[model samples]
Target: MHAIIQSLCTLWRPSWQGMVMGELKYRRGGGSGGPYKVAASGRRIVRVSASSEAGERMDLLLFPAAGFAGGARAGEAGAPWHRFSADEVRRYSASLGDHNEIHQSERPIVSGFQIAEAMGALEGDRDFRIRFHYPIRSDEMVSLRKEGKAIYGVTDVLCFIWEAL
Candidate 1:
């Protein structure tokens, strides 16, 4: 497929240096509260998704990568979350060339690539698996715990992970 070929061609890029893999599952009526953007798109959001069932509510429908305008929804809670300024999330997206509505529903979200890079494992890795469960807005407080070779992005109801394989 052309998609496959294109991916291979771009493997030399910084974003592709890691042999990363992961999944973003939406449990319709469940939540995990990770940083995977919602699958829906609109000016409003209700529930959060997770890489795992950190929460139990999924209102995914429209998924955006960035570029939008509106108020952000409140974040869920379970683990302690810290503030991720709008400017940080916004600037990261601009550099990522990800300007989609779902990624920017109300608050901006940190992209998978950004997270992986932040974890200091995006480049020169043999393999990685990044999983997103929910979305972390630019203006939201998120949680992350790093252990060994894995870094977890946690929310009250969601959990995102980047691990080496």
Candidate 2:
């Protein structure tokens, strides 16, 4: 297993009740084929592996519940993690002229794009994808943490995952 995959497993170990596996493979057009389903036994977990034959690889994980039961990762306990506030998210949205209710709501949900812009800058502009498991509400303070190349925002449960594409 690659170190990044290993690190990701460790990050998900606490809340996601499933396994993580990746088989690095390539496609016909000279690209790494991946993310294809590898067959799953239950909804608690779904397998994603590289397809030997394919077009685009679609790697993913489906857990029993949102963020595997909807809560903060146990690894975030103690010593205070970085936080993102509703004010910060809202302010960012205003600056971007994105007045969409999702980011403009009184108890707004943070803009996934803002989180991507702020947290994934290291990965470069428009170079990453963010998967939001649960909404990151602006009214509540949530902890933000970076693990490997992935950025996570969580309040009581895992909210979003910002990572390299």
Q: For model 1, what is the error of residue 154's alpha carbon versus the real structure, in angstroms, after optimal superposition?
A: 0.9
lDDT of 2 by residue, 13-126 (tens): 333332222112212223443333343233456443333243433234434433333444536722234455778877876665553555665676565445544554444433
TM-score of 2: 0.44
lDDT against the true structure, per candidate, is 0.42, 0.47
- Give lDDT: candidate 1, residue 93: 50
RMSD of 1: 13.6
Candidate no. 1 TM-score: 0.44
Position 122, candidate 2: lDDT: 46
Identify the candidate with maximal lDDT. Answer: 2
